[model samples]
Target: MMMTMATAAAVAVEDSTTDDVQPLSTLKMQAAQVAMDSGAVIHASPDVLGKNGEDSAWVTVNVTAPSPSAGHWVALFSPADFGYGLPSYLLVYMFANVSPSFMSSGSGNLRFLVINQRSDYAFGLFSGGKDNPKLIAISNKVSFANSKAPVFPRLSQGKEWNEMAVTWTSGYNINEAYPFVEWKMKGGESSKRTPAGTLTYTRRHLYSYQIGHELPDGTVVWGKSSTFRASPFPGQDSLQRVVVFGDMGIGQRDGSNELAGFQPGAQVTTDRLIKDLPNYDAVFHIGDLSYSNGFLAQWDQFTAQIEPIASKVPYMVASNVVVLCRCSGNHERTYQDTGGFYNGNDSRGECGVPAETYFYVPAENRGKFWYAADHGMFRFCVGDRCFSSVDRKHQPWLVFAAHRPLGYSSNDYYATEGSFSEPMGRTLQGLWQKHRVDLAIYGHVHNYERTCPVYENTCMDGKSKQDKGSYSGAMGGTIHVVAGTGGAKLRDYSAGPSPQWSVVRDKSFGYVKLTATDHSSLRVEFIHSDDGAAHDAFDITRDYKDVLACTVDSCAPHTMAN
Candidate 1:
């Protein structure tokens, strides 16, 4: 059952404190003064009061704390309930400290103890030092059991405001899921209540709290307070925006490099991109990410190269033919030929070399090389560069992406078909017509091209386009786009009247940004790396009224392409 917040009767504390604790008062005064200096405001009361019988209180405080330092404290206690056994949750946010591990540096601290109850278990945020802000868990009332540390680009300093939040998902379910407590220390050591045994949480009934912190002696200070219940899927409410491109091998075609005209080889340029990555939840690698040539060392370097970006977002991939061809016929060839497949098996293999790691799709779709995932209003259909059969199931949304384009110009000597050709055009075109995929993306052309919505070589008029296509009114007429211009060598465009189906084509190094505003409208823009210019863009809208409604027989295979 879904959980909802209940309005519990508020019970004001009668005595306020069991005993007038001088040390606690002193600490509060010092924190308040420091917060005032740092331009922060401290509320005199709790930010949130627990519901009746729910034993929990959250208070926000201001501290004028220096950054990169540690050891500060805040206290929380319920006046109505003094005994233990009734568990509660807490969450804190740091509004000032941006240091890598500000939590431990005393940027923000929290302390809570059951007046009469023994602590069971606890899970929330903590910072060990300037380098160790981690999500820690304690069990069995002993040592730290689990921790997830943040991987920041570099140590942070200054009065930059940052936030540290904690949520306790379970308090009861002792023995089954142990109870715990979390607290910040006055000096440096942070404390957490340990559980008697192991604990596991099925439904996340997270109780949240937030507060603000400040430091005066150059000690790290942060501010925070509970906001609202966050969505289980972070970033889901935002439109699913993704930058798709591939074949980026270190350098660029234009004088400026990756990320739209950023200076070539400028570390800050890449850093900026990494820092801004949270704006988008995922990325699609059409192919040729590192030009590693199946060399484990190169692959390692490649991974390291994109660590700044990959560490934060979901990096999805399609295969690159060059990576495949280079390793072909060698002992390494067997292992690298497939997208992480081994000996004809779908499972990933350790091909004796670090570069032998295979590319596996997300686990949700059976880890098949091809799969589909819906982000907000748009559904992305990712296909394996090698397998066409996977396209059968998800054909309706077969907005295919791979290293090679089914249709291409002959300007490049390698554009012709050979033994490796799988006739993707014939198969995908039939399927596109049957299911009417909205868009197909590919790399390997080493350039960029946007095709008019087309099927069987015929341009689809906007008026003729259907809102619901074969896959529920969810899909529209399919358009194919190529965005391989990510620093790799550039290829000349195919000479001619540019197929009637071609809408926009460019040889500049760049990336494509896709924005889905709703079920029927999508906006795509091509940003050039040469001048940070938006070279081309277009809007594709579906007329839901034109979509053929699905029926038992209408949804059959005959209605779809084989």
Candidate 2:
């Protein structure tokens, strides 16, 4: 059950001399050939001839759908050697009814399936005449939602066109809702349902869905096109790695300038970081991506500059303190507020944008800003930028991270007293104490300070006024390390004499390297950017009971008198 259609057009190729070759008359043919010797139906198009060889040529192929249960498949072949073990050529397959719209409603859903010949990294791009755009995810049948399966293989000189099949199940009527069976791939066999003794997909379980085949180094590469296939499983794993950061607005000197140093030159650092991102899992930006004080142009520049990174990765963001808007008496409404340094002093009703936003890390914890991920033995507790709540179920070994810090040096400029004014301080502290969170990583501070694990301003030491070094062995303390000096301006350090909780403090541009040894031991190293050397290092170990023994009772919080 197969139908084929092909169209021929002239294409120009560039030669070594950088001159466009003359357009040649090319007849593009596409046919369904079942056996090698005995050919199947051959679909041919008229030969396309052009006067100039300097132009590009395009050919279109359309294939018919198989019977409801016939399981039809399609593969594209390059002109050089359409057969296996041939030269390198691009193979493209196109299908009809890729996304059918329903009559009752205007919405339509499109699905595609893609497979690679060997293990090589590839991405897909879509371009058309219209501006209509939508979100899409590529995944395999088994782990489409969680992308646990390795990517499809890549095509070497020996390998031929890899088959990418898209199977469509007719959509039901608008009023009807059907339960599709879930699909599972185990030991390379597709399983419609879990076998008698097989393990089924669980909410807490983490699995990899391979979009294509994996390379020798376990790197999965995707195909260039979108293919849709019906899977036995109800849902597919289509997750990608993303990185998110916000509150990176343009400021006069303090805010923007400082932030620029760390992520300097608008898009320089951000672009490089984004470009260097390892095909990420996903990005969750809390807020303040770009400061939209009054003018829309600033926002445009920031967004445009960030496109390099955001376009590649899923740029999930929240609102922040810098966005401008208005305040309604009863119902808070936000329009464009152009009342900042960049924009004119017109009262254009610009209000600061609200930041507490949310996105999902599918196959992981969902519906919460604070989510957990199991990267190696360490469980990363990425707190909601708002730092409001914590989910205990998803992440077991909690290691929290946020933009703001609850504790800090007693610098008058940005005093620590009012820093934790938001409920985040109490909420996160309580959660950390309850779960014995191994490490709490934070930014925002211009300086870097590592605090011995202390709760409620009290170091775990029961002794008071003890020598500075006396409280060194305070076990189980939540080490509050500040590594905000990624590239930000260095803040002035004012170390208190015999400070009880503050273990180490440094005013330098640097980043922290966190290595998780296991569920129990974790190593944190602060690398100073000046010399590319680690200035400070520390080790934190959890007890057999899984509780961090360090408490605020031992090392008392520093007071003005001390």
Candidate 3:
């Protein structure tokens, strides 16, 4: 898939526990005291799964204890040897109360969805609730047909417009197997192989490819085949669609992990994206992806959840086009005294390791977390560490994309701070105005919000008599959009009156789709995930001259000598 471009600066507010805490953190595993009940039993079946090469499977778990209570719970652990592993990744956990009759009957059957994360799994029954979990019984080991089979093949635009990069995860190392992508032009007779680390030129043609690992014996273990249309040439006039959203943590299809009320909209948004896969070309998950926080196992779950859309299209967690501009979000990079701008322990101790290691973006230094990418007529200066400098003559749409809203928002959290945005949110105001950025999109607020062309807290268009739905001619100021509505619990707008520049706010599960009909017209729509309908939209209509025209403080210095 074609990861695109964006740019911005990092300025964050400390997130509240209600919004950013990882679910697993509620469990005090370190203090867990084993209270074995010989008569109590926990069993999971069928003992095997994924016989058809499926990546995920649903299993039924039956548990019985001497005295079932609200405190009793069940957890799925990976590596099958959770006893000795000081910190085992818990794949999923749920209270026995969810079974409805467990409290009275002392036994109940629950269902769980498990994925091929290249590991073995087991279910454990525990008592004493989350604060003081007690292991009672363990289920027999459950395994997939091929636990180490290559899975979750993600695509990113390569360093060049014509190049594409495919990355995946597997159990085999170089000595055991060689990883490569087998590709062919759509319907072509012959196919070619590109080894891992080598770029494959797909250009603009429709191509089909599959990830595989060649074993020492020369036998090939292949993943499912998928197709993607290559990115159009930069500056090309063609219809382009890109999806942007943030804070979408992993969704529990089996209904586990609901106690925390985290990310209720995640699965629906994911389903909407999958259903509308044919309509858009690429996706940008701006930040707070997976909400994994610190439990590393959730990363696998997040990847499994997004594989359907990502494996087939260009799903960018970082890159917008060619540049990987990033300042890791609190959940991805922050830890106490970790040198991050924020002093929160939101990352639990992850400190950006999993995020930097898991995803591939074309960053000069992956640790810095920022880069640039181009898609047709759109120029994305996507990073949070600094401002992006771009020539707007060819790609008129200069966008600043980040995980946090550095532009404008009216969420209650920021509203109370009296800034209506993150602390130091507008520190980059001068840079944005100087670059004439058309739109700045962000994802930390957990709600939908849009601003009219605004600068310095003033609505540039409100005074110009410009229509709200359609903007034409020179964009006097950048339009800021907060689309953190990609799952996670939705937040409410400020109880106070809406700011004049805050044109719209919707507490719904949805994403923003930017459709560039051509070089001169861009349409942005906030599509609700529940019904796959656009609840709000606006269009920007302008000519190349309008882009070059002076806007507030963005005009070049005048020279009479010329």
Instruction: Write down the lDDT of every candidate, Cα atoms only.
Output: 0.38, 0.33, 0.78
Q: Choose 1 or 3, whichever is better by TM-score.
A: 3
lDDT of 1 by residue, 1-562 (tens): 0000110121111111222111112222211221112322122233323322222233233333343334322222222132222213221123223333444543432222111112222222222321323222111121111111011111100011111112221212322332222233223344333222111222212323222121234332111222211112211334557667766643221111122221132233244345556555456776655443322322332443454564334455644222112221112222424443223211123232322233323323322334444434444555533223323221112355656665433334433442111344665555555554567777756678776656555555543233312222333346678876766556676544565656677877777877765445567778776455567876665444433443222244554556
CA shift at 503, candidate 1, in angstroms? 1.6
Candidate 3, residues 223-320: lDDT per residue as tens digits?
Answer: 77888888877788888998999888888888887623888889999999999998998888887887787677788788788888987777767522
Model 3 clash tally? 25
Candidate 2, TM-score vs. the true structure?
Answer: 0.40
Q: Which ten-residue region of model 1 has the weakest summed lDDT?
A: 149-158
Poorly placed runs, candidate 3 (over 4 Å): 1-15, 82-88, 319-326, 384-391, 416-427, 463-466, 559-562
Between the candidate structures 1 and 2, which one is better when assessed by lDDT? 1
Best by TM-score: 3
Candidate 2 residue runs with Cα over 4 Å from true position: 1-288, 292-370, 373-376, 382-397, 409-411, 416-428, 461-474, 486-490, 493-498, 528-533, 546-562
Ranking by lDDT: 3, 1, 2
Q: Number of clashes in every candidate structure?
A: 47, 77, 25
> What is candidate 2's lDDT per residue for 37-145, written digit by digit as tens?
1111112121231112111122222222212111212222323222223212222222222324311232223222222121121111111101221101111111122
Best by lDDT: 3
